[model samples]
Every structure is written in C-alpha cells, then in structure tokens.
Target chain A: MKNVKKVLAIALASVMAFATVACGNEGTPAVGTESGKTAAAGTWRIGGIGPTTGGAAVYGQAVQNGAQIAVDEINAAGGINGVMIEYTFEDDENIAEKGVNAYNSLKDWGMQMLLGTVTTTPCIAVSAEAAADNMFLLTPSGSSTDILEGKTNAFQVCFTDPNQGQGSAQYIGENNMASKVAVIYDSSNAYSQGIYEKFAQEAKNYSFEIVSAEAFTADSNTDFSVQLQKAKDAGAELLFLPIYCEQSALILTQANAMGYKPTIFSCDGMDGILTLDNFDVALAEGVILLTPFVADATDDATVSFVTKYQAAYGEIPNQFAADAYDGVYIIKAAIEAANATPDMSVSDLCDALKEAMVNITVDGLTGTGMTWEATGEVSKDPKAMVIKDGVYVGY
Target chain B: MKLRNKFKFDKRARQSLITYAMVIIAFVVVQILLATGSMTSLMKGLLVPLCVYAILAVSLNLTVGILGELSLGHAGFMCIGAFTGAFFSKCVQDVITIGWLRISIAIILGSAMAGLFGFLIGMPVLRLKGDYLAIVTLGFGEIIKTVVNVVYIGRDENGFHFSIKSNMDLNMTENGKTIVKGAQGITGTPKDATFTIGIILLLVTLFIVLNLINSRDGRAIMAIRDNRIAAESVGINITKYKLMAFSISAALAGSAGVLYAHNLNTLTASTNNFGYNMSINILVFVVLGGIGNIRGSIIGAVILTLLPELLRSFNLDNLRMLIYAIILIVVMLFNSAPSFIQFREKVTAVVKSKLPKKGGVN
Candidate 1:
C-alpha cells in the first residue's frame, strides 16, 4: 500500500510538471507578442515547413534558403507595406504526420502565411488542415493535382505532374528525338508513378511508341539491370527516368556498367542529380529534362537570383529553390494587392490573400507570366534543360 | 480468517485496475486540456497518432514480451489493415453516410483480413524460431508493401475488378471510382477519425490484450514460452497457443491501422508510414518500456511520440532522432541497471519515511 501510494504520487507530480511545462511554452509566444519584445506591432509572421532532414533534405534545405533570401531582400527593401516580415522555419522530415504537426506548431506561434511543404505527401497532408483552419499555404514545389482538389487557399508554384509529363512528351515528339521510347520509374513513389502514368498516356497521342516500361521498388539496393536490359533489348532510343537525384545517380551508374548508353530524359526531380557527391558527372552528360528554372538562363531576373543564391549558399540553386524564392514574392504581391493589415485575423487575411492571389501575376525567377488560377492551379512554362560540361544548361 | 480472505484483493486484478485507471486518467486529462484550448494544435494533432502508437506498442508487446517471440512484421499487419480498411470505406462511402458506422465496419473487416494474413503467415513462419522467425517476418513486411504497390482495384457498373497492371486494365466505367491506384494508393479516404474514437479503440485494445494476458489460455501460452517441453508433457498444445496469441496481436494491430487510415486524407504504402522503420519503432517502444510490462508500454508510446514533436519546436530538428535515441537509452538504463534500482529504492524509502503512514502496513 505504501509503495503504491508513493508511485501514484510520483506519477501525479510528473504529470503536473509536464502540464506546467507545456502551458509555459504555449503562453510564451502570446506573451512575447503582447510584450512586443521581438516583433513590432505591425509585423507579419510567415512560417516555412519542409523536410530538412530526410531523403528530400536537399529540396527542403533549398526551399528554406531560398525563402530566407527572399525575406531578407524584402525586409531590406523596407518590407511589405511598411510591415516587417518575421520568418520561422520548421522541419517536417517528409512525413505527412510531421508536416501536420509543423503546421499546427506554426499556427500556435501566430503565423499568418505559410511558404512551405517542399514535397508532395507532406504538402497534401498539410493542405487539409490548412483549409480547415483557413490558413494561406503556398507550396513552392508540391506538384500533385490531388492536393488542389477542394482546397481553396492551398496553392503551388510548381507545375502539376500531368502538366510536366505531357509537356515532356510533347517536347520529345516535337524535337523528333526518338520514335521509340522507354520508361523506367520507381513504382513505390507517388510522384514517379503519377508522372509515368500521365507520360505514358500522352506519349500515345504524340505518335511515340512506348516500347518498354519497367519499374523497381524504392529500396536502396535496387538494381536496374533487368529493366535496363529489357529496354535495351526493345530498341528504345530514349529512356524516360522519373525518379529523384539519388536513384537517378544509381541508375546512371548501373546503365554505364551495362555499357548501354541512351538519351536520358526526366522531369524536374532530376534537377540536382549532377551535384550529388561521388556521382559520375560524365554519365549525366547530355541528359535532358524539363524544369521551370534554369541556373544558366540569360534573363536578368534569373541571373541575378542565381547569383544571389550562389553567394548565399556557395552553390547554384536548384529548381526547388527558385520556386520557393518566387513563392515568397508571389505572397508579397498578394498581400500588397489585397491591402491586408496585420491587425486582421488570420482567417480574414487568408480570404483576402486568396482572392488577390487568383487575380494577380508575378514574373519570378523561374519563369515570366506566372499566374495562379481560381482553382489554385499555377501556370508557368518550363524550360528544356540538358547537362553539358558537368552543369545544367538551357537547351 | 474468512473475513481477511474476503477483503484481500487479487494481485492480478489490482494491477489490471491500476493500468485501466492510469489510461483513463491520462485520456481525461488530455481531453480536458484540449477542450479548454490549453494544448497547442500540434499537441492536439498528436492525440490520434498517440493512440495509434499506443495500440501498436501494446499489441507488439504481446508477441515480443509475453509470447517470447521476436516478430518484426507488426507494421505489415498494420499495412494490410490500412489498405483494406481504406478500400472498404471508399467503396461504401457513398452508401454509408454515418461516419461511425462506416468506420466500425471498416475496423472489423480490417482486423479480420489482418488475422487471416497472420494465420497464413504464422503457419509456416512460426515454425522457425529466433533469428529465422525475425528474418522471415521482415521479408513478409517487404513483400506486403511490394504487393500492394502493384495491386489495382476498381468498381464499375459491371462489378468489382482487380488487376495487378494498371487501373485501366480494371475495365471500369466512367462513373466507376478507382479504389486502389497501384502505387498512388487510396486517396480521399473519409476523414472520420476523431480523438474520442481513437481513445475508445485504444481502450478496446487494452481490454482485449489485458484480459487475454490474465486468462487461462494466457497462462498456458506463457507456460509454453517458459518451458515448451514441460508444457507439452502437461498436455499443452504449443502451436495452438502460439497461433492464438499471434493472431490476436495481429488483429489488435489491424485495429490500430483502422484508426490510422481514417485519420489521414491519403494512405500510401510508403516507408515512413507502414514500413520496416515503423515495425522497428514499435519494437523499440516495447523493449525500452520493459518487456511484458503493459503500463510501461503505454508510457513509452506516449513519451516517444511526443518527444520528436517537442524537439522540433525547440529548433533541434537536426538532432531530433538523436535526442530521442538518447532518451530511450537513458530510460532503459534506469529501468534495468542494478545501480539505478538501488538508487530508486533508496529514494522510495526516503519518500515513504517523509510522509505519514496510512492505515496498517502490508
């Protein structure tokens, strides 16, 4: 009896301590806002979320860096409507649950706008809650069409999977690169699978024959020999690879080992493949892909943004960074056009921002004439890029 | 003597009552906090996941702790339940409008399917012991994930069609909805999972597992675990008891899957959700919590689930997993190390002496 009572007392005390700590943390943000210690009276709080530690860390880190650069530039220019932008970043680890958790945490911190959720799954997961809470979410790289379904305030800066896939197919046919093409994809990945399905459907309309289509799981040790051999046997002249950087590197290595060289084409997922450590850059030579941003563009806006990003991060920015960099400017334009004030509630501000975003257009570093439609779809023409002399150059 | 015996409480009953009281107390406290808006939305969002993990931990504890088996495919069972339950709900969502009813049916179907798979897998796999069993279960998990990635199911005016190639091969009408789109998975699952429902399902899992542990069959199974030869000589069927415990554990994990599936808008057979990592995570919860200790499993699940989220808020995202690992190691050391046990006893003695004695001591 004594022992039981002692244990119960300890448990109760621990529970109380935890409750106190949680309450203390929750109250800190509100208290700080009230005290005006860090943020001014008219400061706009913006939060960014992305997978900064997982497999997609490169994309997430690029997005965070890009958004920070934009925020720094905007604040340096005397801010938006004379209200300084205070930015906070959260890492979601590419998990849907973690993404939602990050979203809620930022909401608790009194964030009014969200520039985030670099990957597809996290973006889709967070958008539902964003809709429910009436928060304005502008994802820089999430390109799933399913994410925009029934979501009013959620928007993406990247092209949808179908758009990129169809565009790639059209580009291939118009260039007369090959009449017979093959596809190698990771069936376990939603992004890869979605792109493959759309590309296969569009290839038929372009009079391109899909001689072979093969898939492999998402395991690290997956060898592409069997699939690559099958494609080679089928006389495929062009190989469509819709996978991420790491897998693309592995596939390139395996294909080189098999002594099979074909014109490699991919989507935006292959943007940073050439920069991965220990990757064979020679294998990536002449590989073509469709991307919304090109680091070697001659346009003034693109060149300046790339220069700034290289100066900040000591490396040229990928498409993810460019999209995120543009995402911040888009948000800034919408906020200015909506005449939103910091005093308005988050939901009201979100409504005004949504209306403004649909009607506004921003010429960003990724492309000119970038616009958001009423259905929360983004419109931007991507550039054809190819790896040349160990770097991506506009084709 | 008779009066004393009448007043004496059964030790097992007391422990069971304590576990139930602890769970209910924790649930009520969280509910009150959520109702009063004292908890942040991040914490609120963790409630359903917390329950789901608790269920997984407890069910895994049954296999790894009580049955003395080293199964590493708990998440595989969860995957089966998630995909099947989500598929059933999507098919009948238009017909069944009541959220609770639809979820209940889905849970039943999911658990049944998982149990069937558990039986089929256990028949051949359970014959192998120790490392072999662990390896086979791990393979089973990977196999389930791979198979689900290729499976496509759709419903049209003609009937339900299943294919391994693509949704177009299902030959569905224009009005037909694709239930499972291969790797894309079932999307737009009705978000009917609430904290209250999660809590209720968790309670059901606790009741079933705890009652099974206390039942006669439980004793028989534990006897087999303790000494299979002696148990066999005593007329105990080793295979029957092992299968029973394994199937029950799988079913409970499936129920957890039902809660998980309905909570999310999209259910994918991805590495993060229902993969090798998740299986190992549940095993960690059991081992770190003191194997076979039910109350410890609950505490372990809650703390570990909240630890990462708490760490994220502190701008320690890079070290989130490291900190979680360190905390687990520290807790496990405290639970098992002889020096810590002695220190704990001393502290308890000092605490007891400081407080006044109540009633007669044991």
Candidate 2:
C-alpha cells in the first residue's frame, strides 16, 4: 500500500509536467490581435497555415515547401526591396477549430499575407478568422465555391467547386454517357458533397437517372456491398464515387469483390489512383476522374514544373501539389507587385493582387491559365482523365 | 452529533466554491471580450460546444468514476437529444416570431427530448454490470451514428453540393432538391448560441448536478456505487436512482448538443452526431481532470480544448500527437505514487528542519 501510494505520487507529479509540455507554447499569446509588432531586428515575416501532421500532412508539407522555395527564389532575386522574408508555418491539422486557432496565431504574429492549405473546412475557418482580423489570405488548393462565395478578403489559387462539377457533367453529357448513375460520397466532407452534388445536378440536366445516391461516413465501414446492392438494384450502369482517394480505393476493391463492377467516375481524389499498390488497375478499369492537371497532359510551364517537382520530390506530382506550388508563386508575384508600388497598403496590395488574378491568365504548371470569378475561385475547368493500365492519361 | 459537527466542512463544498470562482472568472473575461468586440462571433461559436463537452464529461464521470459503470454510448443519448431538440427548434422557428419565446421553447423542448430518450435507454442498460455495459453502450453509439447516416426523412438541398475532392456541384434541378442537404451537410441552422446563453445554461446544469449530488438520491446512488449489495440491503431503489441520474445527465448533454447545432449553423450527420472518438476524448478529459470532481472535469475540458492551440505556439508546427504522447509519458512517470509522496515528505522535512522548535516539542 505504501509503495502504491509512492507510485501514485510520482505519477501525479509527472502528469503535471506532461500537461505543461503538452500545452507547451500556448503559455502567453492567448489573446491575439492584428496590429503589427516591431521586430527585434526587422526580419520580414510570412504566415503559413496547413496540416503539418495529419492524414493530409503529406500534401500540406509539400505546399509549405513550395512556398519556401518561392520565397527563397524571390530573396535570391535581390530580396523584395532588400528585406529578407521569414516564414512562420501554422499547423491547422485540417480541423476547423484548430484552423481558427492557427489563423489567430498568425494574426498575432502580425502577418501581412498568408498562403497554403488545400482543404475547404480549414479554409473556411481560417478565412473567417482572417477576415475578422483584416489580413490578406490566399489558399492553394481549397476548391469549395462556398468559401469565397461572398467573402472579398480571401482569394483561392485553385479552381472553384462549381467549375469542377460543371466540367464533369459536360464531359459525360457530351460523350453521350451511361444513363443510370450511382454515387458513393463521404457524408462528412464538403469536398465530396461538392462533387457529388454537381454530378447529380448535371446528370439530371442531361436526363440521366440517379439509381443510387448512398452516403457513407469517413472510413466507417470497409465494404461497399450494401451501397453497391442499392446501385445494382437501381440498375446503375455508371458508378460515380467522388470520395477521398484512400476510401475511393477501398470502395473500388470492395466493389470488385462484390462482383458488381460499374464504370467508376471520380474527381480529383483519383489523381493518385495510379500510385495505389494495394489495389490493382483492374479494379479502377474504365474509371474517369476530374482533376486540375495530369503530369503528362500539359507542356509549356507545366512540363518544367512537373520536371522540377519530380526532380525535387522524386515522384510524379499530383494536381494538389502542383496547384499548391502555383499558389506560392502567385503570392510571391503579389508581394513583388506590392513592393513595386512604394506606397502600397496591405489592402491596396490585396486589390492589386485581385486585379492581377482577374486580368492575367498564365498557362500554369497545374493546368491552364487561371480564369477567376469575382468570388475568388480560379476557373480551371476540371479535366477528365482515365486510368489506362496504371497511368493517368487524359481522355 | 457533536463529533460530526466538529469536522463537517465538506471537501465537496470547498471544491464547489473553487469551481464557481473559476466559472465566474471565465465569464468575466468572456464578457469583457464580447463588450470590446474582440472575441465577437467566436464566443458564440465555441461556447455551446465547450459547455456541451463539459456537461458530457461531468455526467459521464458519474457513471464511469462514481457509479463505477463504464458506459460509452453517452453520445448516443446526445445524438438522440440533438435530433429531438432540432425537431423542436425547427417547429418553434417555423411558427413563433418572438425571439425569447423561441429560445425558451427550444431549450425546454431540447432538455425534455433528451430526458425522454435517456430514461428509455437507461432503464434496460442500467441492469448490466461492468465491461458488458461499456461494450453495449459503445455499440449503441455506433448504431445511433449508422441510423443518422442511413435514414433520411427529407432532402433539403439549398441548390449546392460541397465536396472535398472536386468543387461545389450546383444542382439547379428541382426534384433532387434536399432539405438536410444529404451528404453535403445541413446548413442555415439558426444561430442562437450566445456566450451569455451558454454560461447561463452551464450555471443551470452545474446547479442541478450539485444539488442532485448533495440530495438523498445522489447519496443513495453513491451508496450503491460503494457497495451495491449493502445499498440494496438498506432498501435503496437502485434502479430508480440510476435511471434518474442517467436521464438528467442525458438532458444536460442534449441541451449542449442543441446549442452546438445552432451555434455552428450547420449540421453534418457524418461528423456532428457520429464517432466514438468524441465520446472517448470527453471521457479522457474527465479522467485526466479527476473523475467525480466537477471542478476537475471543467478544468479538464478547458485544458484539453486549449492544449493543441497552446502547443502550436511552440514552433513544433505539426508534432501535436508527438507532444501529446510525450506529455502522457511524463505525467505517467511523475505520477508514480511513491516518488511523489517521498518528494512531499522530503520537502516537509527540509522545511521542518529549517524552523526552530515550537514549545520544545521537537
């Protein structure tokens, strides 16, 4: 009993230490404001928001690296009016609450401008916080049209959700596609909903019948048998599962096992379909997905980007990574443009950047030139690519 | 009676004072921020969820720590309450034009809805013992999540679909129009969750819980927890008290859920009502803060909610889980009983040695 008490006491003390460390740096900067802080030595600060360590970290880290590269390139080109830019990355973990927290942290750090983070939920959370704080913000990959639907302060470097949806519907309709459609969507994710909603709406426009519209929770159940059964009963000839890549692959494998193979149409989640070693190409046979770019699809600037990205990361770049790379360059261009005009305020710079986005169309590495709407969505019509023998080749 | 009166200053009462003080301090800070417009909408956004989590942790602690029942399906009741409350709130919103009336109706309706579900679920499940209860409750939670996902009463598509992979598909078609918006998420919920409302509800919950704990029912429940057989021998209606506690707990949790749904202005059947992780996290907060201690649960809720934000400031960037892991290890290590007692005694002895003897007793 004495020994047990001793052990308990030691454990409690350690717990205090653990709690302190776990809550590490949130020690003082609890309340955050946007007023600029005088630097100790006048080092320029750039803000970054993304998931540094969740399931999406692989994509988020790459985006951060791309931003770093752009910053490095600019500094090398005689330092944006002779002031070296230093970046502070804020990890939102792709969660809404954490995203709000990160945005406040960046605002507290007095960031004039911020970039990266592809996910919609984080973007919404960050943009709301940033708008409240009066900061200039841009996202590389968040494609939710609802994000910038009414907001003016935030700008997205990626295409809007509407364009992707419309593009998918147009592709299928023009091609005289299958009449009966089945969709499996991630009920929790807005991104999945965006694509599924678009496809369903477009299908309706073309007089295509939706046989099965089943929604599944994220990674909830392994098998798609029940959903597939619903689809089969409805006599769905074309299957549209616009879900995340991980779950999409799982569904494909499950659907194959259930012996109900329908022609699968997915969205950008299928960008990395070729990279799935666990499931073979046979499962994804005749599957078409809409994405921003195919590595081998574009030439001009895209070729150079794909070459450089593959050289650096030692792998073929997906649409997410490429768009993220472009996001960094766009911000750099804005910062440079802002610096070019000597008396430019942050808002003035934001307007100028917004104008630049609207007027200019660059044949970007991600796909084509960005055609933006006033809503801040970069209008890159989703390109439908088919998986032919384990390769993403454009149709 | 004389001897009992000598040591009657209850530990629970002392703890309750500290909890009240902390709550007051938190409320003052919130009030200042709201008045200044610094916090603004965030106070409304976070207040309901925080209150809900606190109530959840505290109420669960009753079963997990005090009553020694490991029920994991608490979220199931929360879900039941949310749906029930949502139905009531929708009904009230559709008819009532007055704001205060709408709010009062919603709260009362939400709590009642939760109580009804709690009473129904608790009656049968309360009969089970130990691990069986935990497993059954856990399963019930999953079952509730599945029900919400599969069963849809109506489609409330406001003409937009939001997806993670692609963009928002604009469904201009009329037949496919939905009300819940299906997989996309049900949006445009009324924003009624304010910091003041949240605090008031929290206070009400605390008052009820504290009063219940001090009452005869609470003591009987505790008595059953201490020794079920002995409690039964003393003619305690074990089932009745357990059901009462469970129902009240469920009602509080449900009220929290209603507040949460309104505050966020959107509800995802997949995320809002689904998942075992939320239940586990709340349970962890309760245990970490010290089960059966209401103040401890509140502290735990606040700390757990704010921990990740705090960690982000350390330049650690993305190593949140690693940080959590390290902290867990350190706490477990330092919490070894013998070491702490030894350390406490050593500090006491050192202080004693430094002091001069009092009345030559040394």
Clashes of each: 0, 42
Which candidate has the top score in DockQ? Answer: 1
lDDT of 1 by residue, A332-351 (tens): 99999999987777789889
Residue-level lDDT tens digits of model 2 in B1-362? 87664455375677677777777777896676556655423223455567767777777776676676777877776666656555555545667766556665677777788788778888888899888888888887777765654433332344334323222233334554333443334444455666677777777888888777877788898888889999999999999988888788878877776766565434544442445776777777777777787876876776676555556556675577688768755644543457865776776666566656663676
Candidate 1 residue spans exceeding 4 A from truth:
A1-40, A220-222, B1-9, B345-362
- Pairs that collide in candidate 1 are none
**What TM-score quantifies how close candidate 2 is to the native fold?**
0.82
Best by TM-score: 1
CAPRI class of candidate 2: acceptable
Error of 2 at A57 (Å): 3.9
Tens-digit lDDT string for candidate 2 (A90-176): 776776556666665665455667784467766765676555545667888777765675567678876666566667777777787
State the lDDT at A145 in candidate 1.
82
Q: Report how closely model 2 matches the true complex, as a DockQ value.
A: 0.27
